[model samples]
Target: MLVSLFDQERSFTRGVDPMVLVSPSIDEEMRRKRVEEENRENNSVPLVEEEKCRLQTEILGVKCSLLRMERDIAVMRIERRVEMERTLKFIVQTYLLSLFD
Candidate 1:
């Protein structure tokens, strides 16, 4: 049912005309816009690239910090489990000794 509805919508939408879509006037306008965009990009590419590099480096640093935090948490969990086991063993041993006495 959803597929049929989507098909209906697709049919209702205007299909592209090959000739008009690729007309000379349209092509010229597109070319002009593209050239303008390229000029702007040429001006800003270095700055944009520099910012992107900095952001990527910061992201890597954050990821490294997160990994270290995760490792620290894992180590703490292991230490906590060991401590609990030791405490439980001591309690059981004391209880057994009392029973014997």
Candidate 2:
């Protein structure tokens, strides 16, 4: 039975829906589009996750390199202090010897 498109009791599935009956081809097209959209989203999720993992790994590597650089800097400071002390001691001994002469 043909019913008005605005009828509330019309079921779209049973051809009694309020909306005009959609052609089967249009329905198939809509279904296909929905599936394609879902597939694209599903496919992209793994790529996004992989990108996140790669970025995290790169960040960790940078942190490790920075830590190593800081450690090296600390070691260099200690070495410089030791060298300065040795140099000061040598200069004092030279001054003492010259005074005796």
Cα-based lDDT for every prediction:
0.87, 0.86
Compose the digit string of candidate 1's lDDT tens values, residues 4-93.
656666766468532212236878999999999999989899999999999999999999999999999999999999999999999999
TM-score of each: 0.54, 0.64
Clashes of each: 0, 5
- Looking at candidate 1, the ten consecutive residues that score lowest on lDDT are 15-24
**Which regions of candidate 1 fall more than 4 Å away from where they truly are?**
1-40
Q: Identify the runs in model 2 with alpha carbons over 4 angstroms from their true place.
A: 1-24, 93-101
Ten contiguous residues minimizing lDDT sum, candidate 2: 1-10
Question: Could you tell me how far off, in angstroms, the CA of residue 76 lies in candidate 1 after the best superposition?
Answer: 1.3
For model 2, how does the per-residue alpha-carbon lDDT over 7-67 read when each residue is reduced to its tens digit?
5454445655344554568789999999999999999999999999999999999999999
